[model samples]
Target: MPTSSTGSNPGYVPRAAVRRRRPAQPTRARTDLARLATRLTERDVWLTEMLHEHKVLTSHHITALAFTGHRTANRRLRELYFMGVVDSFRPLRTAGSAPEHYTLGKAGAELLAARAGVDLPATGWRKDACARIAFSPTLEHTLGINALLVRLAANDHLPLWLSERSATRLWGDWIHPDAYAHHGAAESDQLLPFFLEYDTGSYNLARLEAKLPGYAALAATTGTRTPLLIHTATARREAALRRRLAEPADRLDLPLATGNAQLADPAADSWLPLDSTGPATGRLTLSQLSTHWTNVTPALTPDTTMPTTGRPTTLPWRPIPPRPPADRT
Candidate 1:
């Protein structure tokens, strides 16, 4: 593993990363007649759009979000991968089987652009770019964050999900969180807007700590606070992070909490607040987090007092099976 200046091990890049290459094959794995008859399903297009937006997603993430089961999702994904509409890779896992990670393939990008009446460049789809992302050191972190969002979507607890690409449009080149989201709508008008930091405990603690000033500056500019949720690999890492967070600093009044990888569910009541002086309270869910730490502020936009709820005017992709019927007799 290579180490960056920050002393954190670069994300795991396996030998397969450099060896994998795009085959000079046609875009359709099925016969021309079958392809013509079926064309592209709505779900197929939706999957591509998701990959484009999120950069990378595991097969399980896609299944939980789009299909009824792993078998169905896996079958479709394999077809798509062979058709050149999606690219996939399985990294080296230390333990059990590793899930296949998927990215937008060349044909998929073209399909998205055609559907949207936009050009290829506008779609930002490049075979090389997809390969680069697949091999990037931060690939694991990216997939981990997507997994969190997928779990939320599975429970219909995710009302809005803004990929880093969409978030960059608001914050520009500065202060890009892993993801910007609002915990699914609640009974109260409370729209919880926050940023997720899916730390792998790879980088130097000091380098990670250095990012605090940027968040503080972002808050100062927007005139509102944004809660940052961190999910780390271990309790020891979380403690070290909390200690660094405790250091005195001006205008850094942001609510912070830490969770670990061993957590069965990231959105469950598993986070420990940094500023809590009392003995450790139980874990807090995403919805409960906002209220649990009153000091944590909702994200804001610089131009207006509007909350950064991350809700798009139109949902980019529709969730499947729609929420179950309202108790129909």
Candidate 2:
């Protein structure tokens, strides 16, 4: 039987030449966080930050916490509440008929607590801190991102810092990033050493291209040492992610296989990926647990209620101003 001459013809289309369409961008049902400039004064932002930072607040009790002025405190309380950044103050405390204490809601606290971890079921302190941190869906997102950050920080492969979404607060409508990454920003105080962001799902390159100008502007304000990083490692969506990784803007992208990945210490000249059995090819995952998590979330049970008893001592952010050098004669 003679083969079809058409198969040998130059005009015949190869099976691989079939038409292929571009992959659709991943969609995330993100929230719209309204950050009105007028909503809060700088003092208000500071107070809100403090409230979220500690996950508890009492204006009457926090005279030396982070800022001064009752008016400032009142202003922040009103602004944070109005902007929906906060749910309600602790135990709904109030004076003269109105609520006073500034407590983070499930979302507000979680959003601001971006450096904190939120894996409640797996860890103990993390669950408690997250519970104490209060519930904020935005915060929840940030919590996940921060958790990843802490993990990265622990990796000997890299020295990571806070960056992108959490630091500059430009996460589109979704106040919190899906992950935490590093960025270099300028802060006179040493408390906020860096900035970073975490975003899950694949995004269109052109869309992010548009956000660069704004990101660049923010970067200019950050310190010289800051560098921005963004990561997405959803195992279920790796192929789509890999395509995005090929884009030009992805030069800074760091790859983590999530459960499939293992980070190596830089001192080691060789690296080994996990073997089929799931055991680390080179070193054990970790024999000892670490206590360096930035924040932990705890779920509220019947036993866990608003911490009762007496007033709690407030911790102040005081770093002795860097000592000036002394000259030797």
Candidate 3:
């Protein structure tokens, strides 16, 4: 957890794109693939409808709808455009723009034609009625987070916390991770004891700072130590993040763990992988965290949780909802 001093500062440090499995270029779905592609996976269709209804879209607007993250939303938008579902209409004046604008098109209407029946909760943790938040991402090739969750739950694999976003109360629509730990053949609890926030660099510093109080409050009330677990991917900020978290972290008496240090028992730390395999040895050892830190504060200061205000109706997300039971007439 960071102090108020970090919140008062504001400076920008650019970063290179973190490499990831680029979702296949959104292609024209036809024939077999058309049969495969039914409707826009929850959020994509909803966002297409929402943008069309709202008129235009900005990067910030995407954040409000809560479609994973900026990167995910951006990728989906590209897909929508490629599929002729929507149009980006980037101004011809410059190839790059800070906040690109978006508009709806014919394909977008088609995407939304049957969207009325799409029953994702209209208001979520932050009043974000994003459809994408509902369905789990399907993997065509390798093992994915949801697939891992299912495997762990089914005793096929151990537990792992590869969660991105969760909306818990006593805080707000904040970045709380979901815990999926498996102990032998036992079914994994849908939610883990709790997990920590990995942080570093200026961006992470600001987010971790503002988030500390919320997390602290959550722990105090729930009697759960969802400690702030920051992984310093860089060799630079590790020292500072450790120093900053050492004392205030003690205030909460939470089970704090870092990439370099394990908080006594990593299993007790709340992020145990479902199958008891743990990230490394019954613990979270993602080498893929922390690339930024020493971040000033402005980026993280907004104690606000979501694009919208108020509570989000919690619907099961980690696992897609079961198919509805058939009606017997």
Candidate 4:
């Protein structure tokens, strides 16, 4: 080997000639649809479906809807987050921390798409779904809508809850309500289905009154009167809204009512009809609302059945998530 370049043996390599390997970087947990299919419970699937439909839900909202306690919900949510089935973000606030808001993650979208027999793109989920919802100007409004529904859902009386997107999908051409729900006593067959308009008091009274025409148009076109329940942030706002809306509501024969959001029980005697004449001694319960609006027919059941020539079809949205299984212990 002719002295071998240095004093090293023929098989020995110099330190400079030796290749240095960088430390192995950790890899993220890969989301496997098959693995998730095997691992996810019915309740987990329901939560994901809810996230898909609702756009976003706070940790508190999720807990109220499904979990018995915050600890349990948080632990399970963390597991879901690691599994990439859901994404969450806590907004920056001036004082204290905000609850983690959850939105459908990539894995969740894939899971829902499979369940719906559609491709991922067809599900309308994007990689930035969480960020989009977190930064949107309507975040507060969205949460308000969800907060009201969560309270109703907690009572186990909310059978059908349609998010604004779904509601718009079904009736966007006619009117846009904050939400649509069918609520009643858990044991009763009767349900009170209505269009909910959650007013934050940001809109002027005139602006609020302008929405009545679209609702009137919807009622006239469908020939099915759906009560419009306006939930105001304060009693003063409710009073002003009632005053402004009363005339249009009556003239159009729109079955409408106003309620203060401060009421503890939304289903209780909290709703005041716009057409009430005498002193407001007592308010009406949600179930009693249909009774008050005598001509208002029962909400049309979710159906795909083709309608006769002139009538509008009520396209269905996903039903409310099934209640968590009873504790066997």
By TM-score, who's the top model here?
4
Tell me the RMSD of model 3 versus the true structure. 14.7
Model 4 scores worst on lDDT over the 10 consecutive residues at: 1-10
Clashing residue pairs in candidate 4 (N, C-alpha, C atoms within 3 angstroms): none
Best model per lDDT? 4
* TM-score quality measure for candidate 2: 0.29
- TM-score for model 3? 0.36
Those runs of model 2 whose alpha carbons end farther than 4 Å from true positions after fitting are 1-51, 54-135, 152-166, 169-195, 202-210, 217-225, 236-239, 250-329
Tens-place lDDT per residue, model 3, 1-329, is: 11111111222111111112234754543213253247456555545544443334444344433443667657766776666565543222222232334555445544443333322333121112222221112111111222223322323233232234333322343345422232222232222223434332426555555555666666555454433444443435655665666666655554455542223322233232222112343344321111111111111112523343343333222322111122111
CA shift at 292, candidate 4, in angstroms? 2.4
| Candidate 1, pairs of clashing residues | 269-283, 269-284, 270-283
Q: Against the true structure, candidate 3 has what lDDT?
A: 0.36
RMSD of each: 6.9, 23.7, 14.7, 16.4
TM-score of predicted structure 4: 0.82
- Candidates in order have lDDT scores of 0.65, 0.32, 0.36, 0.72
Model 1 spans with C-alpha error above 4 angstroms: 1-13, 17-38, 92-96, 186-190, 248-251, 276-280, 295-329
lDDT of 2: 0.32
lDDT of 2 at 316: 20
Give TM-scores for every candidate, taking all chains together and pairing residue i with residue i: 0.76, 0.29, 0.36, 0.82
lDDT of 1 by residue, 224-301 (tens): 777777778778898888777776332376677778866777667787777645456676777777776665555643
Query: Per-residue lDDT for 1-329 in model 4, tens only?
Result: 01111111233212222112224646644357888899788778888878877888877787877877888888888888877788887665433345667888888888877776667777778777777876776766787778777777777778778888777766777888898887775346466789999887777889878888998888778777889999888888898888778778888888888898667667688998877454454689887776666666533454623223352222223555535553311
Off by over 4 Å in 4: 1-30, 185-190, 276-281, 304-317, 322-329
